[model samples]
Target: MIEICKKYDCVGCGACISACNKRAIFMHPDSLGFLYPVIDQKRCVDCGLCVKSCFNNHKPTFIEPLKTCVGHVLKVEEQVTSTSGGLASVFMREIINNEGVVYGCSGENAHEVKHIRIENIDDVNKLKGSKYVQSFMGLTCNSVVQDLKANRTVLFIGTPCQVAGLKAYLKGKEYDNLFMVDFVCHGVPSQQILNDAIDAKVADNGNLRLVNRVKEGGKESKYTLRLLKEGKIAYDQAYPSMGYITGFLSGLYYRENCYQCQFARRERVSDITLGDFWDRHDDVKGLNNKKDGLSMIMVNTENGKKLMSMCKDSCELVEWDYEDFIKRNGQLKQPIRRHPKRDQFEELYCSKGFQSAIKESLRGDLNRIRKIILFNLIDSTLSTIPIIKIIYKQLKLIK
Candidate 1:
């Protein structure tokens, strides 16, 4: 009788369902909107396969990234549209050009984060940019297995845990054509919170056509968060404020497993790692200082290095110092600091709604309250002038 406990035990990778020969395990969402495995005793064979496939319990071995670079896509249009440097697009172009399959997170319309596949060159943008919530893995593990068995090339990009889950589900079978990529994740917020945020941010409460977090301008541009509708820009704001970004950056919304993540360790399990190169230290010499933003591409395995080199023509590749990059971006070396009110926030969110939960949780937080007060004060002062008032209204700073 194998069991997966809720709240920090299971990552809902859907690997267990793929591993189960008896088909006894099923994923069910918990109160916090995260999936955990549930077992049927009537069909139980006591195979213990599910437990073994768990990335949390049975961790993957470490492998240092083979190569690391700070770079961006050579195509100006692609870079502008991408979240950071447009490297994923570059990699996808190479893989898809070879008629390979690419799997990644995409669920902006449904207001859910789920794994999606892209084989068409035009659909590459579907999986582009960042998804802050934990993506629903579903039975994609089984799909990957079927694809690999057919000897098809596969490029799967996901969080470290999802990558581990896929690898674990493969039962140690290494496919030469398979390329796995993960990123410097700062943990994922719950789906419920994200859905609520969509409702809060979308204009006219329209559908969430696409969720994109892009550094709008080089270096100086604040992240412009957009919730689009039918290719029309309906909702837009500078990110890290108000709804999902604020809660996420404030560390109030994260899965319990994130605080104890083993994948956050310096050594990675995926073939490739992608993240924003903050370059806070300004120590990487001879590179153009693109204030727009650059991606920190860390090739974890030999296979990853080969794939990255193949994309040299697609991107402006520059050497990245390992120590310096890891210094500013600590998620490479360790897990993000867990919010003190994480548990409280979850409890409230489950009991009330996302907005109420987030608001109430922060009510007791004096530091955050002070900061909000200060910002409003400054904003109010600047909003007095006629020109400033117009700018404030345009920016959605004032109602």
Candidate 2:
């Protein structure tokens, strides 16, 4: 009997499934639609390859970034359309122009999110924005290995844990042509929740498409989730339709493993890390302070430096202090603190649907609501009082 890592530790990167030569490992969604590996008992030869490849069992080495900076695409047309800074798009384009392949998560439809590969610049648009749900990595790790073996330059962009899983799946074989990039992950809610939200909005069964984290007036709308049915707006992230994003930001419905993520530290597993530069407007010199998106780039390896060099012509890169960069992004310091109502939220979700469950779970918490309101009030007021801004932020009032 070969035991893979515990279910609570699995990030569902599918590396274990790809590492199995006997095809014994299969990924099945749990009650909440989060995937976990399930081995077929009869097909098992006790080979332990699956266990060996499990990122939980074999942790990848983490290295400090060689360079860190705040950057964004110089082209206004491109920056306005991207979720953050448009740096990822620039990197993808550079890779494609260099005759390399790029793999990234794409929302195939309103209901499905999965890893896909692109070799052309036109296809890079599909991989541009943020897909707030977990991406299904269906044998994509194996594809990465194959591409590397064929002497093709490959760029894989995913969550930090996914990068570790791909490295573990290779059994420590180093590939110079393989470049990995990961974001400062805020943890992922199960795709099922997102699908359910879309279904609730588009009850008429019309053709549905999802455009997540839309930009408004050339500025990224961080709280927006848009749905298109028959090419018209069906559900916008307004009052009643805001349940999914609320739950996501509340940290109430992420995968169980996300609460215990080992990759949430400052040290990174990927060659490069990209994320929204949340502190760009916070007294940082030489930073673009516009409402348009900006990215915090961390070059962790020589390959990462090479990739950044390729994008230098198209981006405005400003070096930044790492401590200030990590201050606003909570995911870089530690895993999200699990919400107190997490279990209750899941229970209500199983009984009622996603929207109703969100309402119920978040209801009857006047004290919490009051605190949030008061925190926002003080934080907002600090802008006018400039002197209190530092004091308010240092208090750490509502973490």
Candidate 3:
């Protein structure tokens, strides 16, 4: 009898279900909105087709390095409305203009992130910016396979692992129209955390209504959240906090396999991988002045180079040295901080869910305030050699 573990390690790839010759495997949805495979061991012949077809255990396709590739450091107008550089949107625009469909994650309602297909350029608005959470793959993999079989041009944008899974699922299949783009992902949070955060916000303010999770705000926008309370506009007090970003970087919020991600190596499955150019030194003043940030562009394949060239006019193209780019945003072989307290704090905050986490975050904020006050008092009592000068400068900047 073939046995399968029904735990967190099972990523719900459904390869086992598809590979079962006796048709014993089936997909079952769990409480976390992820689907896992279930098997009827009684009918199982244990032929091992399921294990052989599993992408999780097999080697993925790799693209050979291109001889000559062009790298661009461009300021995208749409990127201002994006979580990172607007390279994904620019790439989608070109693909859509040629009557192609783009597949990516978009916010639905207020909190949910769902996989969507954008054929019309107008529909591109839905796919903009960072969701900060792991998007449900849903039936997208199956859909992409069908679209490929029909000879439709498709541009699939996702994290490195998702891209690898897609290519692995469609192994031995080739299509000229298919393009894959992966992000320089820090990490992804659980979908449950996102939902809980939104729910907590709504519960806190009875009239709080989430308008849109936007990267850009027009004149009416005061903060990230646009709320209607007692016929008055209210915004999220938390803007640009390190909660989500830090959580991702610390790996306190990703899936079980993300920490040991096989896709983080040099051999990438996607044609192009894009990330924020956070450490660029070219005209820092100009780049910083803009509301939207710049992106670190890397063309991993010849096809990526070709696609990037087509969008030269729309973007401010500049040469980015590969060595410098890697030094700034390259993958870490280990966690950011090896201290146990950081991990303990993260687990306490994250596992407590959003409501409890918010309360703890407030306590943290108070602690920070208390430290600032103490530092100021100490500086005032100590010898005055601009002791508190740096702290004052930081406070002014934050304000």
The lDDT values for all models are 0.76, 0.82, 0.59
**Which prediction has more favorable TM-score, 2 or 3?**
2
lDDT of 1 by residue, 18-65 (tens): 888888877777777776788899998887887777766665877876
Q: How do all models score by TM-score?
A: 0.86, 0.90, 0.70
lDDT of 2 by residue, 1-399 (tens): 677998798899999889888888898988788998999998988989899888789767998888999888988778887888888888898889989999999864667788998999989877878888899998998899988989989999999989999999988887888989999998899989888877776677445566767777753355656776766887778422336876776787899988888888889999999988744225445756445778889999998988888889989888887876678688888999898998988888888878888887767554565577578556555654667766655664554
Kindly give the number of clashing pairs for every candidate.
5, 0, 0
TM-score of 2: 0.90
Candidate 3 accuracy as lDDT: 0.59
Better of 1 and 3 by TM-score: 1
Regions more than 4 Å wrong, model 3: 1-36, 39-53, 62-77, 204-249, 283-292, 330-353, 357-399
Q: After superposition, how far is residue 49 of candidate 3 from its true place, in Å?
A: 6.7
**How many clashing pairs does model 1 include?**
5
